[model samples]
Target: MTSLSTVLKESWGLVEDRQDRVAQHFYARLFLSDPQLRDLFPVQMDVQRGRLLGAIVSAVQNFDSPEDIDGYLRSLGRDHRKFHVTPEHYSQVKVALIDAIRAHAGERWNAVYEQAWNDVYDHIAAQMIAGAAEDTEPPYRHAEVIHHERRGADIAVFTCRPLQPLKFRAGQYVSLECHYQPRLWRTYSIANAPREDGTLEFHVRAAGGGWVSSALVRRLKAGDMLRIAAPMGSMTLDPQSRRDIVFVTGGTGLAPVKALLDELTRYNRTRFIHLFRGERQDDDFYDRRHLDEIAESCPWLTIVRAVSDEQGYPGERGAIPDVVSRHGPWRDHDFYVAGSGAMVNATLRRLTEMRIPSTRIKYDAFTDA
Candidate 1:
């Protein structure tokens, strides 16, 4: 078997020559050969194709050290598991990829190139299979949308069903695909616990000019079909731990934190939970009543609502981290922060400055862009 490093080094020139063509052909062959897989991809093949090729190029170019290369491969394995991509699908991809490379490389390509790619495919497929087995709750699209509600300017809540029963750790997100208009895809964290009932829910906030989000908020209605990728992300509650947990969220970031809170109660681990949520105003908050109810029922749970626009309500004001630092004990508890990239970064920076270890901080930064 050829070593991945050796193969990659030898095929550098060929990969460069055929990268774009290979990506185009890969999608063409995938859709042509397997229509079902086609539905799993974005409607705009050109955009997704560029992204796929760019990812591959970046991986290869960044293969400067063994550790970096191994980490990249591992991440690919993990992502493949999220999509439930099988070894057979990888095999199909390999066949099409090789053909694409050969077609683009022309006479310069030889038996060595074929051997190199074969080794690469085998390595990636083996890792993917192993990873899929290790993931106890692999991500998958649950079901189509049955109902939806527009609660705020850009916020919409959706009720859906999964194709299979989804058993997810709280705070995880599912990727959604919209068929109409811009026809792009994005991921939103689950806002509800894994109920005995067959329904799942998501709260989405439309960022202006956001392709899928704008469509879902303004145009999508009941009974419309949409595609959901499997649940993915590492944000969740730790059941085995006995320490108090603090959940801090901003804007639509409350979705995953809400799911985590629900799961904690469901498991009956009544650890102290301090939820500090920051939004523009009272009306900007989604599902505030439900959160209040959780706070009321669970003596260990405390809900703190913070508004940046301090007009009518006199509560904790300013940024979430500032509010948390002033009101809460920063040294003694586990923390989970979720929200936009700016919020996540701000919180992380403040926590670090407060001498909080990196291990205690877990966050789901909404990076849909």
Candidate 2:
């Protein structure tokens, strides 16, 4: 018998090029079958359309790796609690997904592929349901903005206090929804560690078509309220490993990195930490003052500033990966990278080129809200 992964991958390849069409068909069928489900999504379907296909692609890509994919599915399942997704919804999605695949696969669709997809969807649904059930925290929290500061023309730094405690590791991220962008949720890293006052800090940049990010950066104020979902992601510190660390950050990617650093300052006594923050222009370096303050007090920490697309910069120049490369011999050190997809991909490529082991590297890449 052909393995489930093999069948799923082959079937996925058949419809991958027509992802948008598949997603559209799937959602259409989903909404038609159960019109009430339409209320769960945003008014604008553009970004939401991409997210559905993205999740499917991710699942298909890791089909062969049960352990790897199971963790992801569980986290996804837990996160979907914010949408109030039930097991019945999973069944509806599975039906729509299979229909979508069949519609797009045309003459290539087969019973083997259908059975494989059904089996895999069952597994995925089971895992997600289990994950959601295992989680004890609430699906979302109501948070009141306590502070908001515009750091640049496009960037804003804000802090919010959740009505209930939000337990999260320093390097994890949480999805947030605001009234201004109803039903649209955007993930942002918590810029601070778990605070005594139950405050969470986030740094956001308004991208061209990012509705939620625009609202966050431009319209959100001290009294505004945000609905934040449970924390997710695994790019966190390893308490067991005391390996010297290197952190690479670009743009507003500094949020999680700063959170990790803040946590490290409390308990890290030995690891020599190097933080390299890069920006396109000198003026875009927003968190230098706090970083400099930390570096001054912690002799174990070193800060390197880099500016690309700017001429005659006093500090290191060029892309973040290039700057990091110049300071290398980092093969023995654990690395954490956070940035835009392009930035993270570039850094990952550089790290791979330099023969850094995958186990030693952790990263989080964010898309526009």
Candidate 3:
């Protein structure tokens, strides 16, 4: 008898190559089975389809890890409450998912494969349903856009005032839904520290074909109403930590890093800090002036700018991971990394090789998808 992990791996391998088709087929089957369920999804299925496949892959890969599926799935389930996901909907999804996988896997599909998938779905559904049951927060928080500022060409920073006193720690992110897009939602890190005024800030980097991001960056304006879900993220400030800190940020991943910096300022005593900012080139330095101001005021903070694929960069040249490798040992420092998936993975590998403890590292991979 094949183990559950091995079965899942082999089955996914058969369908992964045709993921787009499988996602399409799955949604088609789902809506056909229960036409009313269509209302829960966005009108745009392109991004949603990819998200489904990504979620499934992530679940399978981490289901049995030490952190286990519960941690990630519970967080996902809680956030999914904002989407109006219910236990009944999970039934439709599982049926659709299995039908699609069987159709795609063709001859590779067997009774054992079917049983393995059934068990996997059962476990996933149990965890998600259990988590959702305990979540008591409102599905979404009402926010009024107080300010919208664009930096360079692709990114926009928005300041919003939650209608209620929205409580969240620095370095956390929330899923945002614009009134204009109806059910469409995107995740973005909060860009500032918790304020007495109870305001929130988000940095959105418009990615091609991202409905929520393009709308947030280019079309959304001050005075527009936005709905934000409860804050989610673990890359938050460690209140007890007194060790030296290292921050590595790429692109708009700088949002959360900036928030941590803001939080650090309120602390009476903070260890020395090193920040590495990575981008395509100098023009992409969207928050340099602000970062410079922070570095200037906080003598403990040092900023290093690195540019890759650009010629004649003045300070540091090459990818951020390479710059971090060639420059510092970073030993004994609490490291925080926020960046694109590739950037985060590369930096973590390098950080481990530099003898940094895995426990001391915190990272969030910023993605609009």
Per-residue alpha-carbon lDDT of candidate 1 for residues 1-369, written as tens digits (9 for 90 to 100): 765566665665665755777788777876677877876666666556766556554554444464445544654566555445666787777677667767777676788767766765666556666666566654545367889999888888888877678766678887777667433657788888888876777888887756777888888787777666556677876666678888989988998988887788876654788899988787788888888888788888988888888677777777888888887666878899999999999999999988888888899888555
Q: What ranges in model 1 sit over 4 Å off?
A: 1-41, 45-50, 53-126, 129-142, 181-183, 267-270, 310-313
Compared with the true structure, all predictions reach lDDT values of 0.74, 0.91, 0.86
lDDT of 2 at 43: 92
Q: Which stretches of candidate 3 lie above 4 Å from their native place?
A: none
In order of appearance, the predictions have TM-scores of: 0.72, 0.96, 0.95
Best by TM-score: 2
Screening candidate 2 with a backbone cut-off below 3 angstroms (N, C-alpha, C), the clashing residue pairs are none
345, model 3: CA deviation in Å?
1.8
User: Mind giving the per-residue lDDT tens digits that candidate 3 earns over 210-230?
Assistant: 788989999999899999997
Sort by TM-score, best first: what order? 2, 3, 1
Candidate 2 vs candidate 3: which has greater lDDT?
A: 2
Indicate the residue-level lDDT of 196 in model 1.
87
RMSD of each: 6.0, 1.4, 1.6
lDDT of 1 at 354: 89
The candidate scoring highest on lDDT is 2
